[model samples]
Target: MSIQKEDIDHLLNLDKIKADEKNAHIVIDPDQCAACQAKPCLIVCPALLYTLDETGALNFDYAGCLECGTCRTICPHLKKWEYPRHTFGIYYRQG
Candidate 1:
């Protein structure tokens, strides 16, 4: 899949707005993430939403998330971690 420059810019702008909105956010369980030695969420996130901190814990940015389910699939250590609420994640203009 290829994205045009304009589309990329738009997505970036949207992400900024999404992040700024406090109501819509990524909810993560640090305890659930802490024991994850594999840290698959760090690599599987297409938008790099799942980032690591100085302590090696997962930090997430819901706005930049594409909601592709990659993190959900790659994470073998956790049972469930909630993402942005419905209708609060990325929205592509085109399929």
Candidate 2:
């Protein structure tokens, strides 16, 4: 079956993310990130949470994370990785 943009959008809309305000499940080492030339996290994150600021510094928002562990697997600069606390993080609406 051919997947249209509308079909993808509809699938995305079915997922819900509830962020943990006080806790972030993923942590990247700035020192490591600064030294790294190839920042794969920028492209590998399905949630599109990773970005580079004007100063070329890496920035990430834990909110709306898909909890997919893509960053942890792809990022060598990652300092810490864990699941969010109970009752926080993504809630899949799809069956």
Candidate number achieving the greatest TM-score relative to the actual structure:
2
Model 2 ranges off by over 4 Å: 1-11
Q: Name the TM-score of candidate 1.
A: 0.59
CA-lDDT, candidates in order: 0.63, 0.81
Q: Candidate 2 residues 1-95, lDDT tens each?
A: 75554664567698877888888888889899888899898888766677899999988888868889988888766878899999998888865
> What TM-score goes with each of the models?
0.59, 0.81
> lDDT tens string, model 1, 6-66?
6656556635334437554445677878877877776666566677789776787666766
Candidate 1 ranges with C-alpha deviation above 4 Å = 1-26, 76-87
